[model samples]
Target: MTTPTRARAARRTACAAALLLAVTALPTSTAAATDAASHVEGQLPSGATYMMDVPAAWNGTVLLFSHGYTPAGAPNPAQNGPDAATKALLLDRGYALIGSSYATTGWAVTDAVPDQLATLSVFTDRFGEARRTIAWGRSYGGLVTTAIAERDADRIDGSLSLCGLVHGGVANWNNTLDPVFALKALLAPDADIPLTGLPDQAAATSAANALTAEVDSAQSTAAGRARIALAAALHNIPVWNQPTQERPAADDWDAQQANQYQAVKGLLQIAAFHRRQEAEVRAGGNMSWNTGVDYARLLGRSSVRKEVTELYRKAGLSLRADLATLNRAPRISADPGAVDWMSRTSSFTGKLTKPQLSVHTIGDALVPVQTESALKRAVTAAGSSSLLRQGYVDNAGHCTFSPAEQLAALHTLEDRLTTGKWRGTDADSLNSRAAAADPTTPARYVPYRPTPYLRPYDLAHHSDGQ
Candidate 1:
């Protein structure tokens, strides 16, 4: 399994390759004419950059795209859509695409919600109102897209959230913190790693590197690997990381353990430590806690309990001592003010008023497939389950859908909106449509149900203390 860091680098390389292909495939004059006729770029008063593209034969429908999170100080590209292939296909099919380089990049959900709306306002003011509008986003952008669908249902017709953290903010952050808390208790009890409130990017990166090194060293032994599996299970990290391979078998201890270690390391460094730091800065303190949590109970309820048991049995070890140690360790507590702030700023109450179609990779480690489950529960509780449909691709890796898969999801949502009912959304049917559209990349759709979220922020759903 490729490490999370390496997988990200590979995605960047693939994007570069796609950009190169897009450039070389088009004649220079044709490219220039297309840009001249359809492309428009501008900036909002708040310094958010935006770009819009409309085809010569307008379809009267617009796709508003919200991009994934960008780290602070990273270059914010004016991406008009999710990927090169998707963008090309949308334009070819005569749908207008628009996107905003959201103001203040790192975890900018507060700014993104309004900034994206502002960009849409600008588009309507200049080009006239779109006859139909669909809000779409990937990863973090998916959360933003859902917020828009909930808050501006009258303005948008439908929404597509691809690999989004739709489980709401409190649950996402608390779940991320679970592994870090477990790692600290079981692996580095004496290490001076600040789990939250990092002063800056340098501090967060330094902490992440330190945690990664500890995880790397811990992977050398069977007991250490068992503890890592405990942490991974608490967060619902998938046992597969490679996109081209099937999930490792239960008894394939070596392969399964390696993937679990990677998941733990990646979650601690990126999601728990670094992202938590940024989130703490926004929330004014730590918003995650494990106070009064029962480690033994958490382990028993974990989806990967059987896998952990198998690993311990193969390694001639017992998990009882480790779980006891975790139970005895001092637990972290959240500041009340910070918890309130995060709850207000991050969580979604379902409350769906528009048609929403969410797509996720079955083996997404970072966001995890269980997020979709949480969202489903939320929508059900809100009595809007009729408005929601979720589809999954069989591949591993986060947001790793091919263009055909993505377009097929869009078409599925369009079908729902047009017919007022979901049509052909089963894995076989969706995969057949995707394959028919683009045979180059075979569809990997499967009927895989994810486990329930382990550390949901909702007290009713959480396994541990509220």
Candidate 2:
């Protein structure tokens, strides 16, 4: 089977494992309840560390937080909430918070699911069971939370994913591969840059440094910048990078390309290469392939095609020539074993039985906003659209949500769990809610509908054609 069958394959693998070790869910007990505020920390059999915060009031609800990616060799701190401000608010409101720092970092979805389940076990075993368990995650953790919602429906009540890579790992790596691959063919075709099969983290850094030099050099000329725009377009990466500035006007091609160039420099050095190397190591081999892709067809579907075209015309360069270069470049191949492993461990079925609400910033570059679009398609395919609601905040940066905006999304999910129907999820309603709740911070919720996901895997309800 092709990539389309990954969801079914993953679900089957998850179910078989679920049968081996039961997820412990206990009945709530007044006898086990504690009166005062408390904190608990412990390590699981896998050496994964977990931390929990219980409020004084004990509201009988627990919020499970799954954190984003932590690159290898960096400090992997355990998080009890998305941010400090959010953590304080949740605890002050009588909600218990808990999270785990998984066994290993970087592309850890294989360990994340079981680590989360074990954390829940530790929580329930110590205190009584929570009356309602809501699972929330940010970035990569958001992917983990959704996977849990799909497989452990009986344990988790609802979910909230913030700035998540919800399109799953395979699609993310493959999509990112496109732009960097194009960058190699156009900017530094003769340079010894290994786009894939990076042997170690050091090799990945070396490759990123090489590409970084190429991007810096390309920024000097209009022709080179136009080529860069074409690559960013193919990746569907947004061209807005700065947090203090407003999004560039649609007609401002130079500003957009400038943003793309700046944004892409860091992306290539960090996420595009570092994460790929780690993932390939964990998956036992390369998991991305670009063997038969058509570059022009992808550009034809991109949202920034006009921007790219206008920039190329102004630079007196042939857009078609760059496209030809990318098409003729040798393609990367995926290992069958690694592909199968990542599919079962890192991909999502979107077969959710629990209610979930996901929110994304419309201007996100690190984890592109279009991931939400891909997720909705996957959920709909599993016949779970009725249980899913999505919201958008007008902002930039990855997981750069304010306390107010974050709380607003959380409250909406709570309302859904209470009402059993989605209401007031529109931008106006959410903006009003954010302002009413936290008047100090600014609210930027806006109506948004993401464009077609350029690398959507299996969101169509019926077949692999999507």
Candidate 3:
């Protein structure tokens, strides 16, 4: 990755401006769908839009798709599911596909869960009840789907969450806060980048730009690189997926650092910074806190700690001082009322009454792979561990999976539903199944373990503060 020099900074600024314009240019209201012989579209009284596609030969099962987060002002896709190929594959298999654009966007868990249920109700009312209903969601939709599974298990036969934030809302927000806090302490210690309570989009954008500049300046020095590595480690941001660039090998320190620099830069500028502001607005105050967080402890417990250490060693920088600095920095606290609101509106209980199969990319920077571990722990605590199965893709990026991988996952869940047992879930087995399903898009399943979440978060606390 090239250093974020003046030219590069200018390019980044231009790109951000272009993105802002594009987002703002989107139509405020959802567009009316063009109905086809096999497709149906409708809108609820609340203005939430929904679309459904049925194959000529209808299968008994319906695949309800919950889409990921849509940044405010961006146009929501008319149909459900992750990509066009997945929708095509499902339709070819004779399954029905349905999805909804919740009435409002931006941290819309409150609207999404019920809006989706309303969509299901409309679907059932239009056509006969599906023999089996499988709820599947990607990213934020994954959280929505999981919530449905827990609270409305009777409505669906099974569930699949792809790259989902199954980790409770509190944990998700707090975990993101880790790296942003580190960036502030190490790079822009005195910058007016508010970690919370962003007054508006302009304020959020300013903060994001400031942090991005800091990251750009720091990318040119060894100490700066080492500090970034620490920040990335805290969030387990993968040192892969540099834009339009091939991923570096695991042991390639220089290449990995470059990739990590890009990752951290993006995280601070858009993923963590901008998204948190939107979330704060929806929650009515700041919902994330780092008040009592211990940075050293967080780093020690991180999945990328070893990688961070190696990167620091290669950069000839002392990691200890940075850790100490983070420990001494003043922390941000959350508004209790806002925290409670987010907890109620979002978060999962893990009390699964139906089988759920979750698929995640091992190196997902947006929603860290540790989210799976946190979900596993919650289900175990709820005595619903038996109902949950997780699969990992040996790749990087957020929700980066081929149609083959997704079809194979759906099949895996279908198998459990059909035979009352898991079949072909091992990495090798799943890869084979995915290849057979679609030889065009090869599978990338791999056996890997994810680290446990460091924060104290669970359904019990989020549900009612019990």
lDDT of each: 0.79, 0.82, 0.80
- For lDDT, candidate 1 versus 2, the one ahead is 2
lDDT of 2 at 207: 95
TM-score of 1: 0.89
- How high is each candidate's TM-score? 0.89, 0.91, 0.89
Better of 1 and 3 by lDDT: 3
Per-residue lDDT tens digits of candidate 3, residues 1-466?
A: 2233543454456457652111111122211111222576778877889998876566667888888888888996545778998788888877878989988877888888888888988777555567789999999989989889988898898999999989868788888888888988998898878877888888888888888888889888887888888888888777775335577777776777787787787787776867888898888898878876778888888876877888788778778888888889997888998888877778766789899999999867778888898899889888988899999998778898899999999999999999998888899988988998899996999997788666647765443211
What RMSD, rounded to one decimal, does every model reach? Answer: 10.3, 9.5, 13.1
User: Could you give candidate 2's per-residue lDDT for residues 1-466 as a string of tens digits?
Assistant: 1242553454456458753212223346331344467787778898889888887677778899999998998888677799888888778878889999988999888778788889988888766678889999999889988878877778788999998988877778788888899889999989999988999988999999999899899999999999899888877778775686567998999988988887788789888888899999888998888878888988998878899999899999999888988889988888888877877776677788888999998777778888888898888877878888888887777888888888888888888888988887998888887887677787888888888677776533332212
TM accuracy, model 3: 0.89
Question: What's the lDDT for candidate 2?
Answer: 0.82
Least accurate stretch of 10 residues (summed lDDT) in model 2?
18-27
